[model samples]
Target: MDERKIRVVVAKPGLDGHDRGAKVVARALRDAGMEVVYTGLRQTPEQIVETVLQEDADAVGISILSGAHTFYFTKIIGLLKEKDAGDIIVFGGGVIPDKDIPGLLEAGAGAVFGPGTPTSVCVEWLEKAVADKRAKEQ
Candidate 1:
């Protein structure tokens, strides 16, 4: 990984067994030159947060298809803040409703990718978010 590579943790939290989208997003981030760590399926919010800290990731990308994004996203955001990891850019992709996008952002999601959104879009968002985040930190 490049020293400047944006490290990201891609996770599927809770009982969400559908991971095709998560794996695809992970690959997209990797192809875009980010260092991606795929946490596989069935991660709890706690486990995801722990992995994020251990990896010292620049961002976290979650994919949920079990229709539990609101609960999980809020939980993850709370845990992240508790861990003092609120600086990490949090994003997600899945069958999320359009109305939920705004709320997710309010809850700390930097970006939320809906179904049919292209991989390039995700990459661009991550690239810009990581750059902007690092710039602000410095």
Candidate 2:
């Protein structure tokens, strides 16, 4: 497997109009030599899952800043599992509260980055998560 060319799908789900962070993270991931497919904004969980399938992505990076992280994250994870797409590592960033992090992780999200997290941190964690998931699948 190509370690440096990790394929990622960056998605903005629900009515979250705040996309500045998503764009920045997408650019940073691209700069890190990862293939990034970004969904502009206002995407549904179904749409995001479809994008993942179409891209054949190894991981998904969701950006949620509309205080709807739990809702969207749970929905996406649930739908992904329902489709037997559990091999795809799910992670995200945004204004996520500390209290909700555990729930998100338990819901099949490999990681969650809160506000003030560096882009480099996300990039590193994403790579490791993808590698780990791939290892488990094998």
Candidate 3:
């Protein structure tokens, strides 16, 4: 609700060569009036976390299509907590199984979107999530 725009870091982690989904989501977030920083393709959890820190991002949205969502997501979340930056919201999408979603959330993902999720849904979720997070911090 403040004048400052919500900042989100969209990243592709691991050996995933495909980045179409990540790019789409990043553009959608930007179109929704959020400041989106795309970390490009094949990033490590450390690099993504460092970008989050440097950007002072309120949330991180990861796109993983290589079936390593659990490992990469948990690592990123762990690194965030280790660096005392657990307040940053983490969400993910791409090739994620329904059964894996609960585990992902338990591992610290705020939400996970599977195939066919609308961009508006993602934008709305980020808006509310960021607002709630900032409000709580205040």
The candidate that achieves the highest TM-score relative to the unseen native structure: 3
- Write model 1 residue lDDT over 38-102, tens digit each, in one string: 99888999999999999999999989988899999999999999988899989998999999889
Q: Tens digit of lDDT per residue, candidate 2, span 1-138? A: 745478999999998889989999999999998999999888999999999988999989999988899999899999888988978989998998899999999988889988888999999998888788777777
Cα lDDT of model 3 by residue, 1-138, tens digit: 567899999999998988999999999999999999999987999999999999999999999998999999999999999999999999989999999999999999999999999999999998998889999988
Residue pairs of candidate 1 with colliding backbone atoms: none
Between candidates 2 and 3, the one scoring higher on TM-score is 3
Candidate 3: which pairs clash?
none
Residue 72 lDDT, candidate 2, scale 0-100: 90
Candidate 3 stretches greater than 4 Å from native: none
Winner on lDDT (1 vs 3): 3
lDDT of each: 0.91, 0.90, 0.94
Question: Can you give the TM-score per candidate against the true fold?
Answer: 0.96, 0.94, 0.98
Give the candidates in order of lDDT, highest first. 3, 1, 2
Screening candidate 2 with a backbone cut-off below 3 angstroms (N, C-alpha, C), the clashing residue pairs are: none
C-alpha RMSD of each candidate structure in angstroms: 1.8, 1.3, 0.7
